[model samples]
Target: MKQELTELLCRKSFKYSEEPAFKLVSGRMSKFYVNCKPTTLDPRGMFLAGHLVFDAIRTANVTGVGGLTFGADPIAVAAAFASGLKDQPIQAFSIRKTRKDHGIVRWIEGDLTPGQRVAIIDDVATTGGSTIRAIERARSEGLDVVRAVVLVDRQEGGLENIREHVADVSAVITRDELVEQWTATARP
Candidate 1:
């Protein structure tokens, strides 16, 4: 089922065209980029992912999900939708890279109280820096983080680094799995 999820994401990504380039958080550049926005931000895929997330969370005994903005946004949205479908009910939250200089001057978004148990969800985990930062912010804001779920894991030591801060890290696909699948199919 997780493999199905990864394949779906790979198919959903919008390919780059003309002078294509991307600087991944892993510091790797490739002409082929997985523009997840096409898959995650879409209506159908979004709905499907939401249901999948809700199913996974049913066993985690978790209450909420959150992470840094952008990459994590889609999954958080999915969680929100799935929560409704599962009748499990969960909220999505967002963390800022830094506190805003103005307005509410907030760092965490959503209904975060000082001692809520929440889960972290993101599209990808490369270096784990962003995940760590989000966890830190969540802790400071008083949330008991149960675990994390990344749509794709770069298999680049990110999982280990994240363990220091969060309960556990789960991924639908790892970097090795991605490479293996890509290689297996490319040998035409």
Candidate 2:
């Protein structure tokens, strides 16, 4: 499953160049770029990602899985769906980038409550800034963030950065893995 997903991402989402040509969210130029949405939104990609992420967090004893909105949304939902199929049953949640001003006035949307164990997930981790922000926000809302997961780690200190907030941090795929797969298949 991992191999299939790697290939799919290489073909559909990963891009590389001999020189640093891609601009990252952190405003740095990168030799490669990864936009997981194209892959995560696909049916097969979702299946593989769902199972992979579920496998990573299955033993964490988390009742919910989620992270900052947009990037983490699909992966969290997919993991939740996969968990249900596996009978582990973890719910999915989303953390808003901005606070809600109406009614509830909350940063999270889900069937979760304060103090429930949850895992923060994201599609990609570059500087790990977004994931860290999610962790902070979750903590502020009274959620217990026990674990963190990223679909793709840029291998640029992201995991290490996230470890400052949560000891348990992991990535389903790394920049090196994608680069290796991309290089292997790019040969004529």
Provide TM-scores for the models.
Answer: 0.82, 0.98
Residue lDDT tens for model 2, 1-188: 89999999999999999999999877989898999999999999999999999999999999999989898898999999999999999999999999999999999999999999999999989889999999999999999999999999999999999999999999999999999999999976
For model 1, the stretches where C-alpha displacement exceeds 4 angstroms are: 14-22, 26-34, 183-188
In candidate 1, what are the lDDT values of residues 17-49, reduced to their tens digit? 235387775677754455566777877667766
Sliding window of 10 residues with minimal summed lDDT for model 2: 23-32
Local error of candidate 2 at residue 24 (angstroms): 1.0
Score residue 37 of candidate 2 by CA lDDT.
92
Let me know the TM-score candidate 2 reaches against the reference structure. Answer: 0.98
Pick by TM-score: which candidate is best? 2
